[model samples]
Structure formats: structure tokens, C-alpha cells
Target chain A: MKSLIGWGVKPVDSHVNEKNDKAWTFKQKLFLGLTPGQYLGQALRNPFNWILGIIFAVGLPLIAYRYFFGLGAVTHASNDYPWGLFLGFGLFVMVPLSASGFMLGTTVEIFGRHDFEPIERLALLNGLLGYFFAVVYLLIDLGQPWRLPYPMFVSFGPAAVLFLVAWHVATYLSVQVAEVSVSFFEWIGWLGGKRFIRRIAIGLTVSGIILSTLHQGALGALFNYAPGKVHPLWYSPFQWIHFFCSSIPAGLCMVIVVSTIVKKTMAWRCDSNFSDNLDRCTLGLAKGASLALITYLVIKLIGIAHDNEWGYLATGWGAWFLLEMAVGVVLPIILFAYAIRHQVVKVARLGAMITVLGIALNRLNTALIAFNWQLYQEIPHIFEVIIAVTIFAIYIVVYRFILYRLPILYSWKAQPEEALAAEAVRPAPIRTTPSPAGAMYRKID
Target chain B: MSGISRRRFLAASVAGCAATTLAGPRKALASGTFSGYPDGMGVLVDLTRCVGCRSCEAACNKEQKLPAPDRPFDDMSVFDETFHDGKQKRRPDENAYTVVNRYNPEGGAPVYRKVQCNHCNEPACLSSCFVNAYTKTEEGAVVYNSKVCVGCRTCMVACPFHVPAYSYSSSLDPVIKKCIFCYDTRLKNGLPPACVDICPQEALTFGKRKDLIKIGHQRIETHPGRYVARLYGEKELGGTSWMYLAPVAFDQVGFDPTPGNEPIINNVKDFLGTVPMVLAIWPAMFTGFHLLAKKQKGHDDHEHDAEQQQGEDGGEQ
Candidate 1:
């Protein structure tokens, strides 16, 4: 892709190809205005594709084998350890990281922070795909994958914490899809749908906040069902709050981490707006993450204090818990504070990377590692690990595919035809002086 | 006293009272703490009387029509079966609904503890099920409807006793297999389960749950030296239908001793209670924030919608 960009082959970012007056067809957009040969050439040239290929080669068969032979064929999910990497990593970890959607939605839409606007679509897309794949991971983990909607449409156990998760995740996934659809609508040239989404954007963002709050907490509350099973160091009376609070930083840091990755790997796909605003956004997001990390740390301590679990802090597990706190929560706090103060986006980016890992470790520790601490530790079956990795790899591929084409990383410039049509309709002759974005489009056209 | 009168002396708690409080108490029985059904049948298993014979295991297998086990019920070596690096004793699995393991408590003769579903007043398995697959019946049996089971095994994760087992090998139709207390054929028919019917030594005594608690206390009182003072399931995790009279301390015989009397669902109620509040409060609160923030936007976002058009035009180059 970088090589193609260097070759002066521009990727599609508008309804029409700039050099030609003709509108870009759907096929042309899908291939990023490149011919089939050039598209294939880039895909095959990237070594990441080969790595994904190898993973799919091994993991796809195991996944099929699991469905054919049953979950026992691929997972070490026994009666005692019912959830393995599937729920521990795929659902628990992915869901929190994907919280980037709601956090950014709240900042940009709900809080009207236009400064954070540049990466809002990327964050929303990140949330949508992360959750979509989390559900994909869930389907693989569920015994009756076909009955995933049974809780919603069939039999509803409205009281169970999991029922809340099922309903919220399902609903939030819709909210996120609607939120991210602005970019999709722009790409597909569906101006009406984009306008409609814009009108109801507030409703969607509000609902996103409501659903994300309950469900992110609900995932933690699922562990509340097994109070005795989860080790006290990780367990808490406020487990849900701990989960909810930590997710704020997790979500913010995730945006920073993802934007950094985008800036590093796919700079060509990013327009000036995204590439230019990313550093400021990283620092701004780091500030939010630092505050969240501090809140999470204090509450984590309070959770232990409220439960009088200070005794467990001296044990090996306590040491491990402190390690998580020191690295995941505390270290990120210090680094973020320093980075924000110094305006060192590179340092903030490093802190964001650590915060993401810290959140993942926290969820994994609660869900799998420290779970059933009284019982012998169960290692997930090899096939289960491979399948989890494969699904994550697929998530990355889908994420890249969207970033490569969607008008998410760049402003979709108005076609010359649309600009002329707007000009013809506007009797006042551009009296509004078009917002910078509109002006950019007019200039390009 | 008759069983009905004995219920006044003790409560027959089978599931948490908190369970009904969250969802508008469709099964609300008189609204206070929901003890088990008044006439709910229960089993009092005297561990001193259990002879380590696996007859109950055999009877459960036959009654449930479960698949044959890896070892025959008559095989005493199955008693030595340990798993997960010998950290786990033989537990009920897809093939077996109950198993008797020999526990040699310190300074005591080998005590045999029959491990099965405690059939809690608020069974964690029943409470955690998202599909409403589990039902704590008026008969005091916590039964499952496998037709609706999603195979998430959340019940398995939620069961503090670690009782529910999954049949993960069945590709198209894996379901949780556990001791349902013979709810289908026997307990619902007002008869003792097959395990109780087949116990040779009367180690398993079946009667109304209140009567069983009374009888359990009487045995402890009448034979002070013969049993531990505590009834294993009484007030345990909001109490279980199947109570135990162990010869040694419960933990010495492989029971989780410190599991508090609060039902597992109580631990989750804090979170569930917040759901309604968040659903109700967040929309208004966040919308209010949006309005406040939008009010400060100074203009009705004449400053580029940003997502679609993030450029300020920066004085329009």
C-alpha cells in the first residue's frame, strides 16, 4: 500500500475520480479506485497478508472442526472452567477496548468537543467492528450459536446479569452501526441516509452512552455471579464499577493506540485532517485516560477496602494484583500525566499502548487467570488459543479493509457535479462562506 | 409435629429471596424472604451412614438414563479418581449425576461425602441462566429445560458448588447435564429420587425440607459424638434443599466452608439494580450534557459538522 502510494496512485476519497469527471462506481470504490491487478499486487506484497493467510490456514480448519466435532474438540472448556480464551479474551477484553465508540461519541457529539472530531469516525468504526467481532467470538463460544438471539426474541431471563449484557450488546451494536454509518453512507453516495443519521445522531450517541454503561458494567457483573470462584484480589463488591471505570481509560487509550497505529502504518490512507489532528487527539485522549486511570486505581483500592481484602494483598495473588495496578493503572497514570504536561504525544502513545494491555490483563485476570483460584489452573486447549488468535486477526483485517476505503480517515470531497448542483440551487451565492470542510470540498472540486 | 407445623420452626429456603425482587416477582410467594416451597421435599444425607458404596451413583445413572460412565458404578477404583492434577475429586459429569468420594479427614475414620447439586434455595445455576432454562420447582428440585439451553455454560460458571456439567462433545446439541433431583419422573411424582430409594444404609433420608432440617438437628442432638454440629446446607448460600450431616468438619470432607450464607444472586443484585437507573438516567443526563455543550458551541455547529467535514477551512487556503 505504501509502495502504491509512492507510485502516485491515489486511493479513492470521493464520489468521483478527480482526474475524470465520471463518478466512481461501486466496484471502483471497493477496489480503492485501483484495478484488480494493482489491488491484488498490494495485498500480496504485504507480508501481513501472508501471516493472516497462515493463521486462517491453520485456524479456519480448527474452527470448522469445532463446529463439526463439538466445542470439546477445540476448547478445554470443562464443567469447572466453562469459559476459556473465547470469553476471557474475545468477549471481555474486546468489549472494553471497543468502548472507544461511546467515549468518543460522548466527547464529540454529546459534549460538542469539535477538537476531538477528527478521529471520531475512526473511534466509532473501531467500536462497531470490535463489538461485531466480539459477538463473532461469542458465537464460537456458545454451545448453541444458532440461539444467540433466544434471550432477546425467544425466552427472556430479564433478571439475569447476562440477559442485560445480551440485550445491551445487541442494541449497542446497532447504535454503533448507526453511528459509523455516516462514513459508510458517504462512501456509498447515499446522501439522504447520511443526513438522516446526522439528524438522529444525538439520540444514537445518548443511547450509546446508556447501553455502553450498563453492558460494560454488566460484563463485570457476570463475574459477580461467581463471587467465591473469582479470587478476592480481583473480585469486588464494586466489580461492575471497577469494570465501568477502567473501561473509560481503556476506551480512550484504545483510540490513541489505534490512531497511532494508523498514523504509523497507513498514513497514506489518512487525509490531512486525521494525520494532522492525531497528535493533539492523542494528548487530549491521554488526558482523559489519565483521569480515568486515577479513578480506576482509587476505586480498585476502595473495592479491596470495602471487602476488607487487604489481607490477600500480601499473598502471591496480591503481588500479582499489585503488579497489574502498578503497570496497568499506576504506570499509565504517571506517564500520561508527564506526557500531557510536556505535550509529548509519543510518550502519551506509549502510555495508551500500556493502558490497553493493562485493561486486557485486568479482564483476563478476572475472567480466566484468577478465576477459580482455589481450583487447579486450567490451560486453554491449543486449538482454542489458535481460534481466538485467528478471530482477532480477522478483526484486524476487517478493520484495515474499512480504514482503507471508508471516508473515515479523510473528508469525502464533494464531486464537481454536486458542488455545481448546490451552486445552482443556492440563489444567495455561498453566503454561508461554507465551513472549512465545505470550503475544502469546493476548492477540490 | 407434622411436616406442615415443622415448617414454622424452620424455613425451607431453596433459592434467594432476592431473585424475585428484581423482575417483579412473578413467582413471588407472599413477598418476604422466599424460603423454598412450604412442602418442598428435601434429602438429608448422613455422611456417617454413607458406606462409600457407589449405589447412589448407579441409581442416578439409571434414573437419568445417562450415558455409561468411564468406570462401572461397581468399580471402587472410581472412588480414587482425581482430576486436574489431583486437585479435584471425582465430580458429577455428563455421564454421572452424582458421585461418592471417600474423604479421610484428619483424626477420623474415612468419611464418605456424596457430592451432587445442593439444590440451593437460590441455585446460582438457576439465577445465572439467561434463557430461563433452570426452574426451582415447588417440589424443591432445581430442574433445567435443555431445549432452551444455549450451551453458554454460564450456569456452570455461576454454580458455586461447580455442580453443572456440559456435554460439550455433542456438536449439534450440547446441553448442561447435572443432578436435577429427578424432577421429571420421580420428585415431581411425590416420590424420593432413585438415589434415595436405592441407598442401602438409609444414608439418604427424604422428607419435607423443614422436617429434614428438624430430623437433621435431632440426629446431631441425639448423637453428639457421632456427627459434626453443623448441618452442611442449612443457611448455606441461602440454604440448599439437600442438607448434609457430616461426621467431620465440612471443609475436611472437601466442601467449600467459607462460602457466605448470601445467595450468589445477592452478589449480582447491586449491578442489576443499577441497570434500570442507568437506562433511565443516562439518556437524560447525557442529552442534557449534549445540550449544555451544544449551547456553548456558540453557533449551531456552523463550525463544520466535523465527522463528515472536519475541516475548519483554516481561512480557506
Candidate 2:
């Protein structure tokens, strides 16, 4: 067999191979390593970067304009539709999709499903970045972002559902950071740090599960505050359950979608184990997602029935709701189930895409479209859309940077394993590379 | 089955049946009840008596220390004001704390309804605020503090009455602007709010919530055919600190008739009750499945090891 890297392939001295690359150091990795020149090079290489550049050029000044002028400048500033895409998409949708961290953590660590070990770190990383960016989106939306910690150490709203969400999301972000830090520990050659995390891995996974379940559900419950405001088809007293249940599939399918994207775009970064088992794992994950989607579809109907909202099914909003259900929920479920059973990997990938769109649509419906059902619709400002896109671009850039360096995609080269073994077994320390996969494999167990 | 075990099963079944029967009716009973504190204060504003004098709007603006409006307080031309969409009425904004909207019902002169915070007995804004920015005082006023507010605007989403307006222009120190029911100026001192006190036609009545309900009923009874059969806010959404007596139906003036008698918080309680259950149950259930799977994997590994050893022995022989 021909070597995968052909003889004609140039040994490019990319940033990945640079000596004293800042990303290799503990301090630099913490900052997301790149020399200022290399960072700018990567930014200029991608066409998406040009789009982001255009967006920030227009949006950053507009954001500053908003602060200098007012929200009225960038937004419609209607009393009827107070919350636009910022809260709608940024907070509601982003939070639930980011639930991937806890769901995958619970499966791999708490449930001891070592077969899922390959993508576990990716899921954790996806979650941490998603949440960190969600907060960033929030800072832009908040009238007073500086006071974000007020709900915690400051005045506490113990009785509010939002209060619960605020506390849990803050705590859960910390939990996810701890969960993903194992990879960072290995990259920095902190063996002691890695071992300590391994010992408490189960506890962290369990806590992640608990926190994810509550806050994801809590986001939906936030809508329950506006019983009359949200359309009947979308509103249910059991909305929390609907949000929580749908998030399972959303989170699961998000991993499949992200991994698929990574496989296509950054194949060099992925290790052999991850690339080899990906097809089987994708099928397995799609099966789980399909089951969750079916449950979600049934419960969604049950919620409508429980609220006795059959009359709403005849309306225009009802048609839109049905379309969302048919396309986002039912279609994806059918495709995923069919694709998984038939071993059609491409079809399963398509289904995962549909599921991602479905989650976004459901969130958009709840937050923006269905909200203020009686009021005129408020389209987000052009600048607002640009800013949202720009932020997402930044998210992808950060995601790519981490994947290129972290042991998350590629297993770390163990440092002088023979020396450690000989030091324990004999007086002489013979140096050799340790089994790179052993730490992660054992920690996953 | 053993006799002891059979008897225990029978006893458990009987106890379960009895417990279900006892609990079933109690759950239904809890869902139907609605009552506010007997002494909670309330306001009753009669639309028929309101002259559209703009006195209440002026009083509210002055008392709240809100910024000056573009038009003078005495400008009746403001009543004929239209929005950019040509909607013939302007609502209260960040600058104006309160505005009276004129709705011309069929066969009736324009009926003016003052729009401000209803200060519900169970304020949705108070419950929805993540930082506890709002306070629903026992005096039947819903007040807020700007200091600790993250300005998430969740309260704006939660308010059923669509009352809270954000100071979006004030980038440095934006806060929610809404009616506080004069908690600091009057309600705490046992006086009526500025709007109520300054009503020249006595259109606004201030009293205990229970007494306000009675007074509203008395006016309807005396006139018999003058007012609608319903007293707006007497029972809507668990009742509001401010009530209304209009000759026309409440919905004709944009009041949501179907808010139900129960407070908005009651709708949220069902979900809140499940939070603790999910937190407690999911960890153990997932961990149990993990252990079972691990045990199965161990068994499979052990059997495979034994089979390999047998193959090795045959090769040696």
C-alpha cells in the first residue's frame, strides 16, 4: 500500500511544526497558541475569515454605536417584541446544543462505555467552547453585562426558574472546564494533574449530567413564564420536559455533525482510532438520536394534547409548527433510524444535519417566531445578523485552533515511558515513549 | 409464595390503593384555589369618569422623576399621536412611565385606559428575574433596583401586562423603567399614588384590595346597566394591585380575557417541582447501567481469556 503521505507531499513548516511554538507551552496553550503573524496567516487563509472581517468591520462599530447611541439604533426597539435573536438564538438554542458535553460525559465516564472514548474529549471541548461563546453572545445582548455575577454572590432570586438556570450554567461551565482539562494536562505533560482528574472523573461526569438536565429544562421553563405570549402549539406546562428531552437528540446529533465536519475539514488532526471507529460510532450515535427523536415527537404531541391545544393545529402558526415537526423532528428521526439500520453512513450524516437544523428552528420558534404571537414579527437588524455570524466565525476559529494542538483529536506522545517503568521496576531508568493511548483509555474506564 | 411474603404483598397493595385514593382529590383541590392576602391594597380606575386630562400621566412622570417628554404635559394633541406605522396611539416608553391609551369602542365615545404596571399579586417579573432585581411588596407594589440588575430583560419577557420598558439608550446605566405603584412616595405612608390622588374626577379609587373589589361591584350594582358585568383584575391572573371598571368589554380595549384566575407563577410550579426529582434520579440510574455493562464486559473478557488458554495448552501438547 502506498504511504498515506505521498513522497511528493511537501514537508510544510506550518505553525504546527514551529520550534518553540507558543501553543506547545502551558501558558501559550492557555491563550490558544499562535504567533501574531501565524494567527493572522490562518485568519487570512480561510474565505470565512474575509466574511467575518467584513462583519466585524461593520458590526464592531455598530456594537459600539449601540453603546454610544442605544439599542434603538441596531434593534427595532419595539415594546411588543423586547427579545430578538440575541436571547432567542444565543441563550436558548446555544445552551441546549452545548448540552453535548454532559450527555457524552455521562455515556463515556459514568456509564463506562469505553467504545465512545475516541470522541469523548471532542464532545467535552465542544461543550466548553459552546458555553463560553454563549456567555459572550450574552454579554453583547445584556444591557448591563458587567453585573452578570449579581445573581450569584450578589442578590439571589432563590425562587425563580431563571435563577436556577443562571446558577447551574455558571457551575456547569466550571464542571465542563474540569472535564476537558485532562487533555490540556497531557499536552502540558502534567502527569499528576491528569491522574488527579482521572480519580474524580466519575463524580464530575455525574454532576455534569445533573446540571445539564436541570438547566436545559430550565431554559424551556423560562418560556412558561409567558403562557399567553408564546403560541399554544409551542407553549406547554410540560415545556421543561420537551426542552430537556429534545436536547438529548440535539446534543447527540451535534457531536455527530461536528465530528463529521472535523473529519472532512481537518482529517490530519484526527488520530487513527477516531477516524477508524467514526463510521460505526456515527451509526451508533444516530440510533440513539433516532430513539430520542421518536420519544421527543411523541412527548411533543402529548404536550399539545395535555394543554388541549388541538384548535391551534388549524392556524397558520400551526402549519409552521407542523412543518418544523415534520422536517426537524419526524424526518430526521426517520432518516436516522433508516440510515443506521441500513449502515448508510452518508445518509446518517444527512440526518445529523437535519437534526441540527431542527434544533435551531425549534429554538428560533420558541424564542423569536412564536414569542409575542399577537405582535408583528421583528426581524433582526442586518448588523445584528452580521455580529451573530462574526461571533460564530470566531467560535469556529477557536475550535479549529484547539483541535490542531490538543490531544483531543490526536493522542499525545507519551514522554519516556520506559524511564518511568524502569524507575519503578529497577534502579536504572531507561527512557522510551509511553503508551499514549493508555492514560485516556484507563481514565475513560 | 411464602405466607409471610403473600401477606406483605397484599398489605402493600392495599396501602398503595388507599394512598392513591386519598391523594387524588387533594391534588385537584390544590389546583383550583385562588386567593390573595386579605389586606393587600388595590386601585380601581373608572374609565367613564376619566376625562383624558393627562393628569395621571403628568403625575406619574413627575413622581417617577422620568425625563421630560417632547410634548408638554397639557398637550391633548399627544392623545391624537400616532406611531410610525400609523397606529393611532403611542405607548409608554423609557421616558414616559405611564400613558393613557384612547380606544374608541363602537357606539361609544373614546374610552381611555391608563397603561402602567398592574403590579400583579404574583408578579411574573419578580419570579423571572435571575438576579432578584424586582420586589413585590406586601403593600401590593412591584418595585425594582437597578444596582444589581444584569439587564437580561427576562422581566420584560415575563411581564404578562407588557409594562416594563428598558432604557436602551442609557448605555452606561440602563435599567428597567415601569410603574412601582408609588411604594416609596405614597403606598408605604398609607396615601394613594400620585395618579390616584390627582384624579380630578375621582376616576381612580384607592383602598384595600378586598374593599376595592367591593367598591367596584357596588358601582356596577347601583348603575346596573352602566358597567360591564365583570370587574377587570378582580380575579384575572390571581388579581392585580390595579383594577379597572370600564363600560365596554375589557378585551375591546386590549385586555387579555383568558389569562385565567391563577397567577403566572402557578403555571411554572409544575416544572420547578420536577427539577429536584431529575437531579436525584438520573445519576443513580445511569451509574447503575454503567456497572451492569461493566460486569457484562468483564464476564466476556474472562471467557475469552479461558478459551485462549485452552488453545495455548493444545499447541504445547
Candidate 3:
């Protein structure tokens, strides 16, 4: 019967119906319980929607063209560079960032670090959206997008590293979905569903850790097939270890980055538990990230040493490689250490941003830029770039959609006594008065 | 009780280690590298004897039932067709099963080299395919089944020769297109491929793989001045079925000389070895850590409880 706006703190009514009859209808909830005019005003006001509008204008048509004319229409379609930005960014960059799900799941459930409980759902949601969008990007890139499940039920090539990646990612996507569904159930006021998931939470988290570990590593191992193609500086025999280790920092830092964004943009959605514990969690994650960065740095150096490639550090590619390490790895490591020691959350946030960029650079280097070091570089087609950015924009829109309605950034407010009373009596006093802040909430609320 | 428990834990860990070691998945690597099927048919291309004729290309095009080229086979002007990168050389692609490129040496006469699937003893495309879409038949042809192809194009990345080309233009039935050594029609019947059979200059010599290696070496040995000392593909990428004795260095003739002797799959074995270990160990090990943390917490509180008991006993005394 009460408004959901600024009702972030509890002791609030659970339903948004005027007569307090039942919960808000699905359509009402979708519009955030706002009138159609208010929803349109909100959509028109935001600058980000305009950017998304332009992207879709160009990209959506190109995407349609791609399907009608084939991959050749949007991509350079060079046989020399079989993989372009679609797999390079979509699969490689996105998968590591999505590793946050398993990282937080292990911290809270397996290790009993309940201090991390507040942000656990956020990390899981970030992971789910990242992976879900990665698959979306893949769908755009695949020649036969419809036949994605052929490796699972129809055919088998168990010996390939990609086979391992295909199987593990498929399994892990389900694991992440199950892990995040608890929050979904709570938001929908399904207490029974939440309780059932809670019972299987540990098993799901364990499988998550297992699946995340293998697939993250397996992605790197995919490059092993091209021993001669990739630059030696980027390629290593221990590439799987490098990828897995880097993802640790990548995952932890992503949580910091997402939390910072949520705090800045939508602090109204955050409950005290999330908003209050966020700084402490940032520092905790920074510490974990620093440890991972150091491990990643060492293994990377060790990889070079193992291959007797110390001489490469002086070449042009080596300089480029060093730049990647300095910007993506070393700079973040220093910032994270300084931030953790000084208890400065902002520096940690900055480090997280840099770490994210660094991971993206690393994946792009491995999959595209530094790949085929001896051959001429292949630039992504303009439409390909537009389509990729457009897909990512859609990802952000879906992510924000869920964050607004779900119990991800905040706990669901469940007033059981009010619910019981509403059930017992009909035509009760409706608490539908909107707060002044609800005006802003009503539009983009 | 502590000592006995420690002994039991150690025994359990050892037994667990042994069980995993014994029950480990069959070694995908370390099963010994394949040396290609014995009596596998192969082609020995003697570059010194070949003229830059397009008969083999035309035969391959016709035998494979490929679509007509923009420039017909008789048009020598196609040789001057430069790609976007300005390299006039053409490699194999979806429409063409094989191509002959003319490499103009600085002083010597122009040398023409034919490029097709090398069909390595351990074909990277076959190993990297997750759908089992590729097969290296015992007859030395690396063939593909498009019905099972998922179109991931990992084979495109895996092929050191860059032989596999995807039909990205065909949305309805896009698949990899490459030379198959005429496996279904000729090689299966113990006859040479159409390209080898149609080489009027006798540039391509078809024979058993081992016999070809011997012939390649003998040619290089007898005609040392005419041919390069090394036979390309004999030890490259664990020995492809197609061996070449070029007049100039292999690199000069458009062959990649830097591919290490080991096959591409060998590079991935170390990571594959770790998969089972992580899959087997992570569950119990993490659960153990979880239980240990729980026990440590309980033990800390119990220690405090014991101290209180001790104080009560002291007061009673």
C-alpha cells in the first residue's frame, strides 16, 4: 500500500496497491509504480539514454544486416584473423570480469566471512549480467548462433580446451543463475523459494568456484592452440595460470568498481547494510586484489623466465607488454596497497577502474592486437565496433533494470505483520502518499 | 587424542592423493605423440622440377566442384591479384581448395609454390575442434564434417598453416572449407588426389608417407645444388604428410620456418593435466578449510570455557 521510493529503510509496507489488496501488479512494478507520463519524463531526461539511442540507431541496423547478409557484412571477414572484437572483448574480457560471482560466493559461504554478506548479492548479480551479456555478444558473433548447444547434446570433442570451456561456462552460467535467484525470490516476496535456495547455497557456491576456476583458465588455454601466431610476450605455457590468477584481482576489483558506481548513481536504492558496509568491503576487496595482482605479476614474470624469453623485454612488443603490465597490473597494485594501508576507499576505487581497463587490454592483446605478431594487424570494422558498444549498452540497461527492482543492492523490505493484517482485512487504509523525493523517484525513480 | 588424530589426517590425505593419481582421467597428453598413421599416403612436391603451370589448380577446382572464380583458371592475370594488404599471394579460401603463388626471388627465376592443407600428424584443427567436426583419416587427409560443425572457428585459429576457411557468407549452411586430399573419391580408392594426378610437370609425387620422406631426402641429397638441404614438413609441426623440397629456403618459398617440431596440441597438455587435479582437489580442500575455520572458532570458545572450569576447581580446592 506504501510507495517503494526512498523506502530503502525498513518498517515500510510491502505492497504498492492503493487499497493494500495484494502486491503491486507486474506492470505497475515494471514502471516502478509510476504513471506513464512520469516514466516517459524520466526516460527523456537521462543523457545516457540519448547515447544509447544513437548507438542503437546505427548498431541495430548493422546487427540486422549482419544476420541477413552474414558475418561478412559487419566484420572484415579476413580468414587471417578469424576472431575479431566480438570474441576478443565479449568472451575474453567479459568472462574474467564475471568471475566476481565465484569470488564473493567463496568468501561468504565457503570461508564463513559473513562480513561480506551485504555485497554478496551485488557481486553475484554483476557476474550474472556480465556472463549473460557475454553470451549475447557471442550470439551476435557466431556464424550459426542457433547451434550453440551442439557441443552439449549433439556432438562431443572432449579433447579440446574449448570443449572444457564450453562445458564449464554452460555449467557455471546455471550455477550463477541459481546463486542469484535467492535475491530474485526475496524481491518477489517468495519466502519459500528463498529458503529452498538457502539450503543448497553451499553446494552451488562450491560448484561455482570449481566452474569459474576451470573456465577462466580454459579461456586462456584457448590461445595455446596458436603457439606460433600470438606474440611470445603475450603467449606462455602457463597461460591458464596467468589468466586464472589475473581474474582473481579482476573479479575482486570489479566488485569495488560496481559498488562505487552504485553508490554514486543510485545511493537511494542502497539499504544501510549495503551503503554502510560498502567502504569496509572496498578495502577488504582491495587487499584481496593486491594479493592477486602480486601473484599475477610474479607468475607472468616466471612465465617469461620459464620460456627463456627475457630478451623479449627489450623489443617493441616487449615495451608494449611492459606498458600493459605497468598500467593494468603494477599501477593498480600500487594504488590498492596504498589505499588499503591508508584506508582510502577512493584510491581503491580508482585502482579498481584501472584494473578493469588492464584486464580488458590483456584480453584484447591476447585475442587480437598482439595475436599474429608477425602478421599485419586487423582492425575491427566500424559496424562491428558499433554493434559491440550497442550490446554493452543494452547490458547496462538490463543491469540497471534489475538493480532498481531486485534485492541486489538492497535487502527486500518484508513487513510480515502488515502482510498478515492486509490478508485478514480488505479495504484497509491505503498509505499511498508520495514523498517529495518521490517526484524525482517517480520519473527515473 | 591430538597425536592420533594427526596421524589419521595424514593417512587420509595420502590415501586421497593416491586414489586421485590412480583414478585420474586417461592422459590426454603424455600418451605419446602421434607419428601419423603407418602407410598413410602423402605427396612429395619437388619445387625444382615444377613449372608455374595452373593445371593442378584447375583440376582441384573441377574435382572439388568449386564455384567459378571471378578470373578464370586460364587467366594468368589472377596471379597479379593483390589482397587489401598488397600481398599478391593468394592462400586457400572457401571457394578454392588450393592455390599456387608465384614468389619472385631477387636474382633467380620466379618460383611457384602450391599451398593446401598440410595434414599434420597431430592436426591442430582436429585437436582443437570441440564438436569432433574434423578428422585426420589414416590416409593422411584432414577432413571435416559440416553437419557437426558449430562454426566456432577455433580450427581457424588452431591451424598453423591457416588452411581452414569459414564460409562466412553462407548464413544458411556456413562451414569450414579446406582441401581434403580427395579422401572420399581418390585417396580412399588408393589413387592420388586430383591435384597430384593432374600436375603435368610431375611436381607432385604421391606415395606412402614414409616413402615420400625417403624420396624427399634422396632428392635433396642427390640434387644438392638444385634443392634446399632441408625438406619442409618432415619435422615441422611433428611432420605433415606433405613434404616439400624447394629450390630456395622454405621461408623464401612462403613456408613458415619457425614452427617448432612439437605439434600445437603439445602446448596445451600442461594445462589439461591440471584440470583433473583442480576438479578433484578443490571441493574437499575448500570444505576442509571451511570445517577447520568452524572448528577453530568452536575451540577458541571451548578454551575459554575450560579456563572457567579450572577457576571453579581452584576455588573449590
* Top-scoring candidate (DockQ): 1
lDDT by residue for model 3 (B24-45), tens: 3644543478999998989998
Rank by lDDT (best first): 1, 3, 2
Encode model 2's per-residue lDDT on A286-326: one tens digit a residue: 98889899999999999888878888889999999999999
What's model 2's lDDT at A190? Answer: 56
TM-score of each: 0.92, 0.87, 0.89
State in Å the error of residue A416, model 1.
4.1
> Given candidate 3, what's the lDDT at residue B77?
77
> What RMSD does each model have against the real structure?
9.1, 8.2, 7.7
Q: Please give, as one word, the docking class of candidate 2.
A: acceptable
Local accuracy of candidate 1 as per-residue lDDT tens digits, A138-249? 9999999999989877886777888878877887887788888888877886655665566566667767777788889989989989888899988887888889998899
Interface RMSD of structure candidate 2 (Å): 11.4
Q: Which candidate number maximizes TM-score?
A: 1
lDDT of 2 by residue, B95-128 (tens): 8878988888989888988888888887888877
Q: What's the lDDT of the predicted structure labeled candidate 2?
A: 0.75
- For model 3, name the residue pairs that clash: A1-A15, A441-A445
Q: Chain A TM-score for each candidate, in the given order?
A: 0.95, 0.88, 0.90
- Comparison by lDDT, 2 against 3, better one: 3
